[model samples]
Target: MNKATYQQQFTTEDSPGWLAIDDQLDQIYGDTEPRHYPPLCGLHYAAGGSDPIDGASIYDSNHQEFHRHIVSYGLSELYYDEEKAGGEFSKWGFELTFRLLPFQDDQHDPIWAIQIMNNLARYVFTSGKWFEENHFVPANGPIRLDTETEITGFVFALDPELGKIQTPHGEVSFLQMVGITNTEVEKLKQNPTTDAVKELIDHLKKDNPLLITDLNRK
Candidate 1:
């Protein structure tokens, strides 16, 4: 939608951006109530009591085999503010997403995904740095601390299913975080270019089209 149109339409809505995001998800998820996880604590180093990422919603995936899809809130301007209306890009122009196979026992909730997103948001809120398409991050250790897993890092890609959407606040891309092995991290570091990341993602898509992060994949 055009800036003028969005501005006019969202003027009276309390949280137009938030609603827009929910509406987009509804298209994919229908009426399924996702497992939502709010910020664990009120205090954060950058935003203090207000976290940069307000919450995370995890949905049972339809496009992948027994995987969960996680989406974030607050990476963008989720609430309406007259000053931010119809901007070129929403706060950061994107929210983080992750698709993962069951990381633990089947009954175990995916709260870890929420924690990871908050940590990533904390990095951005504190460092003034932001991630973009094809960026990669090495997790120093297992992506899950104290876990015996080969998945030691991540690579960002536009979510295959959610892709991107235009909101009253601006454009928001669902940037997906895909787990990678330490070996893959080393390969990405060898070139450390968007192309390298893209190539790796492309190769991954051949078998895993949805790019679901499997902690068991070596």
Candidate 2:
């Protein structure tokens, strides 16, 4: 479809890209809708108003361990013809996803992951740096503030299940966040190669395919 046609035929049901993302989540959760969160104060670029993208959180128990999966909208071409829609990579080419292990009795969804997503978005907008598979970045401290957890950095990887989808805009990949400790980050820096990061992730996935960030790992 051309840009004008795409713009005219863009309802949520008719939205190929956006609906595909929702459908992927639906297949996994089966009739369960995620708890969607919109930012309280708008992101810096939105002129202190409403947020451009919405965050969705879903609790998954089927995996060997239970964790909350948070997904971000708006990183890519969520709406039809919002921008040119033909390229190998979608608008930003990827959406940010985070999987966090939850406390057994915890009832409320953790909002920290949403904050991290927004911060990453801000960095992209300001710095023009895009994160891709096998890229590692330092969190500078515990991923969770004021906590003593050893996880101090994050590595990106294609989500095992929600790998990639062809959208009206192009191709979008779901880049998941896997936390690592200072020691692991240093080891990765010494090598500075994609294989080095992949090896570390491969080791982590052996125990947990979802690659849940283990704050207690030594």
lDDT of 1: 0.85
**Span of 10 residues, lowest total lDDT, candidate 2:** 43-52
TM-score of 2: 0.87
Residue 36's lDDT within candidate 2 is 74
Candidate 2 lDDT by residue in tens digits, 53-81: 55555556457676778888767766545
Top lDDT prediction, candidate number: 1
Error of 2 at 25 (Å): 1.2
Task: For candidate 2, give the lDDT of residue 29.
Answer: 82
Total backbone collisions, model 2: 0
Clashing pairs in 1: none
Q: Each candidate: what lDDT?
A: 0.85, 0.76
Per-residue alpha-carbon lDDT of candidate 1 for residues 29-130, written as tens digits (9 for 90 to 100): 899999887776765334666566888889988685878999998898887676777678888898999999987644677777778888899899789889
- The TM-scores of all predictions, comma-separated, are 0.91, 0.87
Q: What pairs collide in candidate 2?
A: none
